[model samples]
Target: MSEAVDPGVAATSEPKEEKPCVQCLVPEIMTAWNSARGACEFVPDEKGREECRKELEEIAKDVKSIKKGSEVIYKAIKSSSNPAAFIQAQIEFAKTHNAANTEAILKWADEMEKAGKEIPEDIAKIVKFYRIQAGSQI
Candidate 1:
């Protein structure tokens, strides 16, 4: 005498795929990081502050990863007139985002893209992943 009225909500409730658009989700993640930063302001005592900072750093790392994913997209969409300036800005932005080595590595990628070549498999692989931190949960 089993009731045959069960719905498929269990299957529908499962999460979707993880790899979102490389460009679209960066700012969204940044906004979440910002909210965490805001909460960090109220963390009292040195130990609590340190713990909050650690979580913030994890969120920052994810932000850095998002920026890397972004560069994989942005090189095509760069707006500056000079490639030199464009690359320079990208490098600076990467540094600001805590990725000091990213610019030098990306320069090679930029050259590859400039030559109308497809992104190398290894580099393209970078664009295939994203795991954003759960910011502001503290």
Candidate 2:
């Protein structure tokens, strides 16, 4: 022997085995696809099973890169200021939507009353408003 080589510095003569993908290690997806396939005696809905299998295969190929890029974007949003302003805007949005929804309920109740159906509570509330407007007792 000429000299002993450092194992860390040396190129390995043996071939390294590639690690299985994280996506493949997820049991739920694999089980869902396996059980969904009828021809394999796993379950029924073989076509659906095949689709899930294809989807998982595609995801496995890109998941590591996809996850890394998404985490960057997510972290940026999570650390943002004015998060409360965003939340307030969302609340006001729900209020505006509720106003429109109430208006539609009133209109629908009017139509239904014209068609001879009894007014429900929400519709009755609108009718009560009109009665107060007309100075008439229910």
- Would you list the clashing residue pairs of candidate 1? none
**Which pairs clash (backbone N, Cα, C closer than 3 Å) in model 2?**
none
Measured by TM-score, how close is model 2 to the native structure? 0.32
| Lowest summed lDDT window (length 10), candidate 1 | 129-138
Residue runs of model 1 more than 4 Å from their true location after superposition: 1-18, 63-138
Estimate TM-scores for all models: 0.31, 0.32
Which residue ranges in model 2 land beyond 4 Å of their true spot?
1-80, 121-138
Model 1, 1-138: lDDT tens digits are 854556855534578767767567767666555544444444444555455546556546545465443343243223223334334433544445544344445556567678998876876554232111212121
CA-only RMSD, every prediction: 17.6, 20.2
Indicate the residue-level lDDT of 23 in model 2: 71
What is residue 59's positional error in candidate 1, in angstroms? 3.1
lDDT score, candidate 2? 0.48
